[model samples]
Target: MSWIYLDNNATSKIDPAVLESMLPYLQESYGNASSVQHRMGREANQAIEVARQQVANKLSCRTNEIFFVSGATEGINMVLRGVAEAYRRKGQHIITCRTEHKAVLSTCAILEKRGVEITYLPVDEHGQIDLQLLEDSIRADTILVSIMAANNESGVIHPVDEIAALCRRKDVLYFCDATQYVGKQDLNLETTPIDILTFSAHKFHGPKGVGILYIRRKSKPIQIPALISGGKQEQGLRGGTLQVANIVGCGKALDIAKQQPHIRNYRDLLEREVLARIPQTFVHGSKAKRLDNTSFIAFRHIKSAELMTSLPDVALSTGSACASGLLDPSHVLKAMQVSDEDAFSSVRFSLSKFTEQSEISSAIDELVHTVEQIRTLSPVWKLFKDGLID
Candidate 1:
């Protein structure tokens, strides 16, 4: 049986064009980007610079602002821990939301043990942070405000422009984890005043193990200490031999994603059909603006793990891939005040520009049938059918 993959937010399949662009570097051009003495090394270095330009063009920032890392995890670590150490004298307080990815939250947990004051702002029922609450959270010693551009699970977009403006007014540094929204949304740093932003290549159609961190230096010189110590690389912020082939693939992937048609219509069609055909199912974060390619739904009284097991051919997710192994419910859903039962029942279906209409239709049919079968075995569902539950 053919599988229908709808988990693009976890990681997307590399585009053919992107793979083609990376082939030369992987096969023959294996010179280390740090080696500056030899011609082959210079060529590798030039290729890396070119890739940096590509990412910079997409983000509408200077090439010097872009720093390549292993992926968003490293980029987040570099920003949070690096800034915590570098700016500790400036401030010890940081502000963020409860719905942040583990990369940000986990790092914040670590900082807290080291005497950093962290305020985890709560979200509304719609999975959106209150701008007023965010503004009020800033203090005299608040050094940074880190939030994701769009939620990985719910796909709900935060009001990043307003958040950036608030941070600017408070004279606080703003960091946006744009892993989900970078390729799907158009962001121009020339217009937006976000101080720091991060995105992973695999979240788009690029090869895995490559990410970009954009640090805007035009407004003010914001400096963070290097996370890794080694020979000079990534302007001394990150020290390692650049993954030349992956960086080349990332550049090509971003170029392709920017030119692809929007997938919002297809995603909407899938959501509509699923809600119409299935009972006791609701879409999470439905009240807020979300990524065009994502649809997060919850089936009442049904566990997503069991539902997914029933539909072997459909590739979906319970939540962020990084945290999926845990048996606990999604923290994102809990942040939105979803009941524990509803949270466990939730599943996220994220699309890509490459998803076809036929694939959507097939997945919908299979999901509806599988959900129905699961509900039949559910005691809670049976109770509801007998008018014992409201």
Candidate 2:
């Protein structure tokens, strides 16, 4: 039987159109963008610039503000480290939340080791941070506030607009990780008041290894030290040869994603049907704003790893792909104050533009059967049936 692929948040499949746009750069136009002396190099350079403009136009920012990087992780490291170095005299403190992706949290951990005061704000039961606490956490010595646009595991969207406004009022630089939010929806940076932003293309049907970092130079006039120093690539801030094919694919992916409708209806049907079919299933971020393509469901008395392993035909994840192989509860769920049992029982079903209704139906049927079959072998499930556990 053909397998159903729902692990889209982990990474999307390459769109055929994006691949077609990138072919020339990979084959015939394979030239060093840094070497503008030759025809091939000039062609490659022009393509890269066009991509920059496309990215900027989509985000409603100037083309010069767009900088290319390997991926979101490198961009996060660059922005966090560069800003800390550039504004050390201003302050050594940075603010972020506990529900952020591992990339942001891990980078903050390193900054803490370097004597930077990192304030990890707490989240509510729904994985949303308290804006009042964030405002209170900002001190005169705080240099920056780094937050993500959405949660990768739960599809919970942070109040980025309020966060940006808060940072602006506090006179602190704000860096937003838009990796999960971008391409999934429209974000006009022109009026958002964000100082810096980062996103990856692979999340939106583009090739991997290419991403963009937007720095506000016109309005707020933000600047940071260079983390990688060598050539003039990325305005001498990031030094390395750009991935020509991947860059082309990145722009095309963003262009395509902007035109596609949200897959929320499919996600809703899946969530509604699963809850009706299962014994005790809960949806995370159900009431809050979320990506239309994501559904995080917790099945009580069921271990997600065992469930996923049993359903080989369904490509789903129990947590972030980075740590889903482990048996530990997801850190995102833990931050939301979910019990250990619920956390381990949750599964993330992320869809994409390419996903079809049939796939959702099939996956849901398989999930219902698997959850029921697995619970039959569990003492915990029996106790729950007997009203022994809540």
Which candidate number maximizes TM-score? 1
Clashes of each: 0, 0
Across 1-390, the per-residue lDDT of candidate 1 in tens digits comes to 478999999999988899999998988888998887998888889988998888888888999999998889998999999888888888999999999999999999999999999999999889999998999889999999999999999999998998998888889999999999988889989888899999999998999999999899854689788888897898888887889999998888887676345588888898899889998889999989999988999988888899998988889999899997898889999999999999999999999878889999999889888888888888989898999986
- Candidate 2: list runs displaced more than 4 Å: 218-221, 259-262
Per-model TM-score, in order, reads 0.98, 0.97
- Kindly give the stretch of ten consecutive residues in candidate 1 with the minimal lDDT sum: 253-262
lDDT of 2 by residue, 1-390 (tens): 478999999999999999999999989999999889999999999999988888988899999889999889888999998888888988899999888888888989998999999999988888888899999999999999999998899999988999999998988999999999999978999889888999999999999998989898855456677777888898888888889899999998998786345478889899999999997999987878888888999999888888999999999998687775666778888988999999988999999988999998999899889888999998999999999999
Give candidate 1's error at residue 57 in angstroms: 1.0
lDDT of 2: 0.89
**Residue 78's C-alpha lDDT in candidate 2?**
90
